[model samples]
Target: MESVSTSSVMDILNLLKACCSQSCNYIMTYGGTFSSLASEVGQLKDKSSDVKRDVEAATRDGQTPRSEVLGWLSSVQDMEGEAESIERKYNQKIKCLCSFPLNVCSAYRLRNRAEAALATIRELKQSAEFTKLADNLNLTRSIKMPTTKTIGMDKVFEELQRHAKDDSLSVIGIHGMGGVGKTALLRRFNNDFPSETEADVVIFLELSIDYKLEEVQKSLFDRLSLTWQDEVTHRDRATKLFRVLSTLKFILLLDNLWEPLNYQVVGIPLPAPPSKCKIIFTTRTEDTCSHMGTEKMIKMECLEEEAAWNLFRNSARMDVIDADKNVRIEARDLVKECGGLPAALIVLAQAMAPKKTWEEWMHALTIMKDTPHQLPGMTNNVFSILKLSYDRLSSDNMRVCASYGALFIKGSWIGKFNIRNSWIGEGIIDNVQNVMDADHKTQFLLGILHAASLTVRVHDDYFTMHPMTRAMILWVQRECGKKENKWLVWDRERVEEAPAAEKWRDAERIALVWNQISDLPEAPQCPNLIFLDLQVNKFLRKIPNGFFLHMPLLRILELQETSIEELPVSIGNLMQLHYLNLCKTRITSLPKEMTALVNLKYLSLAFMKYLRIIPDQLISSLRELQWLIMMDSYSGWKEGQSCEGGVSFEELESLKRLKVIGMTVSTLAALQNLCDSPRLAPLTH
Candidate 1:
């Protein structure tokens, strides 16, 4: 009897292996026909392996295998037999073509046989008993709630719940100032609605400043547990999403909307008559509510005086015994300075919780009083409160990262990878032997900023700071005795002329982006400058010769979306420069002197419509270049340009260390040559 059982197990194992291999190949050859059966075949393969292991253990222990194990083996064998029969039918149908005379009639006959085989396979797959197998695979799991307590928003939560219950309302809008507890109130509503209502599904998504419709669709697909192919087009994804959502009663909660979102673009069906879907979105502006066509608008207000004090005491862990009469007075005075904003109150209280003595409390108050408020349209007290929190950071590296957040446009989405690479170039992240270590340290610094509420995480590896937080960072930079470290004149500030020569001497980083400056001034005296960003200056014409004479430590230069006709030959003097961005310019050609930038690692020349060629000599000199972007240029020969002047594929052989290269369709012929070259094959791969 034992010998019979062992034979049965071995037969099952061999059948299962053949069944899995054939199913995988069939799916690969005929896409979409055998996809449904693939899952069942995989489960059978797993069950067969498990049963084999159990039987082996039983034999080793001198005991018989359990009856349930034998039953699983029998079921797997039966499934394998069905799979083999189907694969045999498919193979036989294909074999008809071998004896064909290669005529239309023979082709038609073979096609009919193939269709019959596919239909048979589909019917068998549908009739198979997969309930028991599915039961073992699917398991129940619970969703965890937020651990942080929601304070001082009881009335707001009640109002939001009321809005959610109205059957006529499709989109509900929540608008408030930044740090006014809008997100917290939304989370509370999301947690409570499923238990109190009859919605079939609940989804929460965070939209960043630069969010795309495809991203939102993918998020919905993930939340619904739906399977999607990676190669599916945007329209197909939208159609599938709409079909799935139209039949269910669902509620979508979107948080941190920087601008008005279009539901149609994101493939979300409107909550019209007969559709029970509802959407709730939060934004910082009332205009955004009007733009989104919210049926009901709710405005979030700050906490009252008593509630603010309660929140402050709770966050700071101050009890009655700890707060005497004088301490109560001082605490009340400090809370008043928070402007009834919950985030400010919590962050300030947490910063002050460590100071138990009266002198310490008084000293913090003195510092707040001494700091000057430079932000327009913001109250002085609120500014002081945020600045005090900035001062309380534990490390200088954290402070530097936080201050760097001020360099971006107030509502721009900052990519974490770009920020980390820039930090490495600027020498802010030290002791890093390689790029991987620098990335880890950058993430750590970003975490610190997020914990302190100095920045908001819009999505994975992307973040943006609140306008008030940005103001505080700028304030700290000006007052922290580092007056010459940075000069940021961004936000479309109209600049008819550049700063005086003396003003640029002490600055290390100078950004005059989004300005109205029409001319590039000569900066022959800037000895300490390392980074310069003059992007989106539409009227700037050209860089005069010898413009980069004095700056030897320069590492990053950005001239994207500018009208610069050419770069100065003097730019080659900065042998230490590593990153140069010249996208969306009108430069006709690159200067031969540019080949002198031996330390260059990243070069972007995308969207230069007038550029006709890249010289071969220029491409071979940058041995350290790792990333080269030359996409979307006008590759056709210019009016007077010769074919010999175009980029040569042979020049790429010397770039042995190249890691990434982006080019347009016109460069495919050249790319093919590079791929065929013996020395460049590895780099291309």
Candidate 2:
């Protein structure tokens, strides 16, 4: 009993000693622990500041904060608040309990709180060491772009969206004329990407009139969050881009593609079969679409009339447009002048929005009709945009050939054959030895023009220039100074009579088509004249005696569907004439003097129902003649028979350069002559 009692007393004594020792420790370590907590909290605050700074910088560069980093920052904030609260309580307890050693309970509670906060602060400081402060923003999968309200593009947009999701299609192309809203459509397409798309990233790039491959490379690098090193080689950059692109599903939107760009050259792997990556591009030419190997092509046509008015009314505000009947009339007429092109309509509407009076509208209309490009917004926005297509043409020959579209009436469907022949006659297509080669080159050039979107193909053998495009071309030509001044165009100028001799003196090319010119000057000293078009001059019955005398350098003379019945004797003086079109004329006979034309290459007399005679030797004397179209007009061939100095089929055999001949034979002898001659028989159609 004595031993057990002694053990129990010893345990009680040990417990009291332990309590006394813990109390002493709590009192002694309180200040150090609080200091430690304050120091760690300050360190955490500094770390948080550094991290926030880094995050801000990364965000400025189009990056976003990492999820883990954000969580850590939030934890640090909470820890800082707790540490601050503990410090305030400790300070308050010390201040209130100063010189009073009896308040151990308050001191103990404050010490306990500081100890707890110190531990938390230390943990936060340890976690503040972040290798990466922020992650890439990944350039939003679909950026909301600022664009004009879509007009007549809902169906096209829906169709494009379907094509974009199509499993079999990897590349889609949108092609149309300049200022036809291709870029606008692309912007809308990019902004309206579905949330459920499989794409992990979408990159939009605008290849300028002369974009470089490095520009594309840099865009990829930026969007992919790869560091761009300026000192690296192009191949190295391409490899880097390809490495990242191969692992992710992405959509690349390429806008304003002037020509075919090799995807491989730019380090873009072709999204061929089995690849989830896709590419879409917008260009002004279908040729680009074909060359780029697009799986689907959507042609962006001009808005319909009603849709155009809607767009215009929205832009110009309907209140002003419908304020007066005259204003509405003028507005509708102005829309027609815009030719349903969105860019033109938008610009014109904006320019006309401020003018409320009918007179002001009328003045604007007159200016638009006369010089559309000179209007306020037309030059900068519409015409200059169209000029890019012309400026990026492959060569000067193409530019010149394209400029010829301006010579015709605006918005007219130009016959491809006539255009090709005109190109041949102007010496634009040189260095060819045979008519076949010339035709081949002509076809290639036509393809180039079509691909450039300078001319829109209406059919296989016809193309038409947009009215706005024509106006832009004419403006460009006029801007080239004196060189283009030689081209005199009066077709759309509302000129009833031929210009005075002074206007015709320095002209190199003249277009007097669709006019009521009843007479021409006796002679104009046009020493540099190369082209003259008198087409569709219904009232023109006679050519002055010396109309062709001074045009020694004349190369093309067109008088199709004219009322003229005879050619002047001076017609033979145009020694350099290459193309002579008298189709649908009233001429009954050809003079013998036409035999002087040795350089004539293309001669068309088709539909000349009143044509009856071609003096013998006249056709053969044109040693350079290659194309002769007389089908449905001249069938007065009589072989081995003398009939009013008429041309025989056998005489056609003498012409060695003729490659295409379209004429009819009315006599058996003529048919036999045609079959007997190897050259003529092979060329005859």
Best by TM-score: 2
Clashing pairs in 1: none
Clashes of each: 0, 0
Q: With candidate 2 superimposed using the best TM-score fit, by how many Å does residue 595's alpha carbon deviate from the native?
A: 3.1
lDDT of 2: 0.82
lDDT scores for all predictions? Answer: 0.68, 0.82
Per lDDT, the best of the predicted structures is 2
User: In model 1, what is the error at residue 539, expressed in angstroms?
Assistant: 0.4
What tens-digit string does per-residue lDDT give for candidate 1 at 342-460? Answer: 87777777677776777766666654433314222233445564664566566786676777677777557889986875665455664453445657888887876765556777887
Q: Each model's TM-score?
A: 0.44, 0.75
Model 1 worst lDDT run, 10 consecutive residues: 133-142
Runs of candidate 1 with Cα error greater than 4 angstroms are 1-402, 415-452, 460-462, 479-485, 634-644, 665-668, 677-685
In candidate 2, residue 603 scores what lDDT?
93
Superposed Cα deviation of residue 308, candidate 1 (Å): 11
